[model samples]
Target chain A: MESLAAVDARLHRELQSRYEALVPVLRHGTQLGGKRLRPALLLLSGAAMHADRTAKNPLTTEESATTEDHVVMATVVEMVHTATLIHDDVLDKATTRRHVPTINARWNDDTSILLGDYLFAQSFYLAATLPSTLACRLVGQAAQKVCEGELRQVLGRDWLDIDEETYLDIIRGKTAELTRVSCQIGADLSGGDEGQVEAFARFGNDLGIAFQIADDFLDLWGDDDNVGKTLGTDLQQGKITLPLIRLLRHDDNAVAMAALDALRLPPEDRLGRVMPLLRKSDAAEYTRKVAESYRRSAIEAISGFAPSSALESLKTIADFAVDRRF
Target chain B: MESLAAVDARLHRELQSRYEALVPVLRHGTQLGGKRLRPALLLLSGAAMHADRTAKNPLTTEESATTEDHVVMATVVEMVHTATLIHDDVLDKATTRRHVPTINARWNDDTSILLGDYLFAQSFYLAATLPSTLACRLVGQAAQKVCEGELRQVLGRDWLDIDEETYLDIIRGKTAELTRVSCQIGADLSGGDEGQVEAFARFGNDLGIAFQIADDFLDLWGDDDNVGKTLGTDLQQGKITLPLIRLLRHDDNAVAMAALDALRLPPEDRLGRVMPLLRKSDAAEYTRKVAESYRRSAIEAISGFAPSSALESLKTIADFAVDRRF
Candidate 1:
């Protein structure tokens, strides 16, 4: 629970043969510095099922948990995460990823898209080996939800009237569902009861929703050096995040429509005028408070999960997503 | 066995809800297409397994000589094929597919990518509900082979020096695997003996390899109007397909190198020179003979399958792939 090193090592071991087969591509393509939060959730949730068990992967030494279960679950979580990023890079027109050129940037659109599907099939190959039907269904349904979220987001892209409900629905699908399933499946694979599994899943969803709200916040207000994303970048892209949505609702002035209309201005000319409009309307503070409320709600949701070191760590991870310096 | 109307209808019926959910996207995206060739193979193979049994699908009015065994087989086979297309579209950077704007083209890359994954998961869900674990494992292994094939293709892209053996390996992984497993799993689901299942699988693999080779031929030699794919498109992309590979030996000559190098030239000039250089060399004739040889091998392979109406239809499909006229 303290760190994901053992799970990471086990995942690396599973990837050994594939990594070798795909050495040149893996070495160059899949950068290896991710937090592996999903895998850790899987491992930790597995631990929570066996009372008083430490959440760190025991696959390192004399292992009790099935090797296939642990390794497959870990790899699947990573694969799902990677597949999303592959698509995300294209959607965001994100040229740089992990300080390296994205797959789309490097290989053009087709190969990048196909590679994402390759990772997906690889993930399914891994998941199909799990010991439980429940695990398979859980993973399958989560994947389905993620697609729904993506479809909604695509529709929302140019909707200038976008609001919190649509935004929340997008985040729930995009971010929360997989995180929930990751923990829930790990618990199921570990022989956990339905109640415990459901609790962990709920915890994951609430945390993910809050985590996303904060990410939206950082896109506007956070320091660029620390966040590593440009401030007001979302505005420049003409996205109506929580703050902008709130500003649209809060203003009662004569030029409110004109101020809202500014979002449709050319992206290159966006930021200069929008920030002051936001400040005059008190929208930024209102948005931050909404995010903070979601954060508190996230903490409250996990209270349904009983006390454990793993539960505590989950809380800490959520807090770090919002409050960390970097 | 003949046209797979019953099984195809069943697959359509079972997938109606998911397809309905995807309808808006599908209308924009076209999952409807040319002959559902892969699903036909699966259904025909399934029919061969239980020659005397009565099976039925309520969705179809077609009087099937073979029952619902083909239905399950068809669904699973289509899932695998659809999964591959989703991935391939990404790899090919194909914005338009089956005469419709592609999912990747209509939706941004991420939605299309995830939708593919969702389909894959749905395939596994559909596969797991069937009669055997062996079927699941067979399909799983085939999916892995696809991943390996794609990764290998990326590793060897634009090599120009790639030989026939390497090309065969890539094609086997990319195309033949799902065909092999599709036939195998279908037979097994319908209670075919071990030898019968294995034999049918081998036949399907050979057929798939032959079909791909002929398709490659069509890409080069057939009229653009007849083939529908852009003319000499593979050469333009610097893809080292069979003809391209065979021609490279003669390509050491200045005229050939001029054509090979023309990929970097202006698009019109590039095709003008490359097309004639390819035609003048023995590459076209050599690849044609190779495709004929594979088609012959496929016919020979099916000789081991138990003789039945279904088996005869399967043989016709393979012949249709290689020698048929549009």
Candidate 2:
């Protein structure tokens, strides 16, 4: 808790000075009520790996110094996440996010767009402070994948022909890529072996995919009061997620056509009609099952690590990520 | 010319496989007949610095290998410029740019925004591939400044209280910063001396500021056919550029008030009403003088360099950047 607070404080301090005019918008975006999942994954994975190494030998000065590096990297990850959220609000025309007025809504689209770019630049600048350029390279590639995934989502709006594979690919790029990079960097910074690094990368990817699946599920069916953000946005925006994709192919396309018809109606009418059909067609159940499989794989990947608190936390995170409740 | 063509070809080759759907928009943005000034500055400065070093000592294997690094850095700089253009179109609601339909106009704001992000990520990825992290750091900071400059511009729209210093600061961030980094990286990668690197950076900065002033000039007063893009967009969008800022303060605020009033009119009538006042108030002349001074400063910054072909070309570029005709 102390380390996390320090990380958040660093974020606030750095952004406050980075652009004085943007401090308010930056604060609004960064201080939003996020779970900070990516940074937590990075810190925990790094600390766990370091602890394992130190068990064999006393903690080296250089290794101990990485406590500072972890905070920087964690801040970078959160900045990246916040940047996406700002742009996502603009793309979705979202008025409120995290129970606060969005940057786009409070200011305008132009400010939101440019502020997002500012945060991205800030993230890259912070990431470059690491000893190796590997983090920058990985994070850059992940950011590219996230943008490409978003482009695909925007281009494919209201798309009916998208299959399960394509949907999985989109989510992988949009969500899984960043989480995978986060874990990979964590392992790399901790001097984890190549196999450990690879396992954590896969773990983060599988867990991220499962998390996004659960999010898509919650967007329609979950309690808005619990979610703390807008619900039914996917349907209102004609976004085709896993649930919709599954419902599309159910019962020889009958329910699929009905689902499509329901999407075309007004938001209230559409959700009312689609809710019962989603339950009856097993789409929600199917989505949850897929998430469960990914979660199981995420847990299995970390089974090779030495039993430790971080490894245990990783296990809990996999389950917590896909759990039905918030 | 051959080197620039190679750079463009490399850009196309890289983006073609990056994202299939994005290739078209990428081509549209990158191949829109830009002057290729930033990359040219990078390549010229690099080659010149390299030539000077080779003269002192026989080229080592590593020294000879920067041909690839130069190309990569040049590509990265151009990618940054292209990304900004894509986003600028969205912010401006521009339908055309560089005599072609803009990404925002051809597709939509969402695609343009995401594609711009893709270009930015691509730039960073390419930058990180360089052996030194300096390019990444400099370019990231430059990109941040560019966003800050843009935010200031958006926020300053239709305002009449801006001073000359603030206006210059805005252009410095919006325009000069990237070019300055471009030249700095070029010299840095080529192993230039501290003096030589600083000279090129200043030269790039001055030249970039002049270029932007000329662009602002063209936006209001140049022939639409010669400029090959939509004109009067800044005025229409209430952007207060150098000429407008100058005119606003001229003649004890009389012409300034008239200029402000003219800006409130429709696009077609506004240009007609403001053009004569701009000329009468000497704001146009004042802007040209400012641009000319920067051009001279740019040339002066490079005066210390040996009488090499690249140095001579740099001098010519200073003049060409601020030339009245495109």
Candidate 3:
């Protein structure tokens, strides 16, 4: 958490520019903080490997210098996340996020759209300033995947028959790929071995997928008071998440019809009525199982890496993804 | 023109990807096919230097190898342009571009926004793959400027008091910066001298400003049939351009009031009434003179480069920016 605060400071320092109108929005996006999970994963990955160096080779100078690169990357990954959030808010027509006014709600859509683009360009610009093109390439690849995935989800709206494979593809692109890259960048930069880097990559991929599934679960069933934002948004927006998909795959057409009719109701009332039906089926339990399985894989991924406290932290983080209430 | 066509072919190949829903929109945006001026400028900048190499240094293999880089950059720059066009369509709510339906019109705004972001990521991805970070840095910087400029324009939408200085800043960011980078990339990759590269950059900056001014002129006064898209769109959307700004500086309050009122009318009738007032004030002529001044400077910027047929071509391109009817 202190490291995340440091990342926040770094973001403020990096994004504060003379573009008078642009800087405030950049600051707002960065400061409208979420869990800082990605930054933490990245930092912890590098820190884990750095801890490994102490027990193994203990080369201080080059390893110490790479720590700064990791910090820069932590800042960049957060900015990338913030940019996507701004754009997603616009697409979802969300009025608030993290109990704060959404960029689209505070400003108009044009400004929101352009500001998202500005943040992305700023992130890439910062990425270019790094010593290697690896970060830039990875970030670009993730950005492409995220956009493509978002488009797929947009096009898939109102289609109730979205299969499990389609859901996996969308979640992998929209959420998991960036998380995987964040971890890979951290490990790869910290002089991680091939196995160590690959391990972190796998850990991040599974953790990210699990994270999105849990997040979707929260949207439907999480505490509205503690979540600090509107719930039942996916249902309101007609987004087909895994739980809904699982519920649809069941053979009972009558229950499916009732669920569909409930989804068409207002957001405030739909989740209340839909939850009972969702619970009557095994959909929620099944979704939780899938998420737990991925979380287990994520924790298992780092088992062969040199043991460190940061590795334990990674396992704890993955568990948090499955176990958190919000 | 053949070179521009090559860039077109290259864009088709580069943008063709496995993301089935995204590829068609990407193709549509790239295939909309404007003047391809940015790509032409890029290719000519590289070719001009290559032609100079034959006369001066006579290095063959490595120099010829970079021609392909030029082609790749040509495609990247065009994709960047197309990306901006896609976002601009969403911002402007335009239905058609270059006589075809815009991506925003064919799909929804969300798709257009995501596709614009996808193209930008793809462009940067391509930039990163090149042999140097110079292109990536230039592109990131230009992209940032373009977004900032667009945001400034959005914030200044209905503000009638936009000064010439603010206007210059906006256009420099939104239009000139990318063109400058395109040419600078071409010359830099072709191994041009510092003077030559800077000259190409300056040439592009000036030519781009001139091009935008000419385009604004066309929007206000060019024949609608020839322009092949909607005319007087800037006025219709309440966007203030140079000609209108110049006309507003006049002491004739009654005329200014009449012109402003006419601009609020339907697109069909606004130009009919506003043009007389604009012509009487010589604002159109003033805008053209201003454009011609930049055009002259653009030609002057590259005059120091070694004489070649491509240099002549660059000169002709400068002339065409001023002299073209469409």
Off by over 4 Å in 1: A1-3, A14-21, A28-33, A52-68, A251-258, A301-306, B1-22, B28-32, B52-73, B86-98, B101-118, B128-137, B155-157, B250-267, B274-281
Runs with alpha carbons beyond 4 Å of true place in candidate 3: A1-3, A59-62, A251-253, A260-273, B1-3, B59-62, B251-273
Interface DockQ of candidate 3: 0.70
Error of 1 at B238 (Å): 1.3
- Residue-level lDDT of model 3, residues B184-302, one tens digit each, is 99888888878888999999999889888888899987888878777888877777789888877767888888877777777668778888898789797788899999999999998
- Candidate 3: CAPRI quality band: medium
* Residue pairs in candidate 1 whose N, alpha carbon or C atoms collide under 3 angstroms: A110-B90, A110-B93, B55-B67
Supply DockQ values for each candidate. Answer: 0.38, 0.69, 0.70
lDDT of 3 by residue, A197-273 (tens): 89899999999999999999998888888777678888877788889888876679988888888777776677788
- Ordering by TM-score: 2, 3, 1
Best by DockQ: 3
Candidate 2 per-residue lDDT, tens place, B1-326, comes to 56777888888876864556666776777775378888899988887677667666655525652488888889999998889888898998878876789888889999888888888888888889876678888989999999999987776644567788888898999999989998888888888878889988999999999999999999987888888876787777777789988887887678778888897788667778898888788887888999999999998987866566777887888888889663
What is every candidate's alpha-carbon RMSD to the true fold?
Answer: 5.0, 2.2, 2.4
Per-candidate TM-score against the hidden true structure: 0.86, 0.95, 0.95
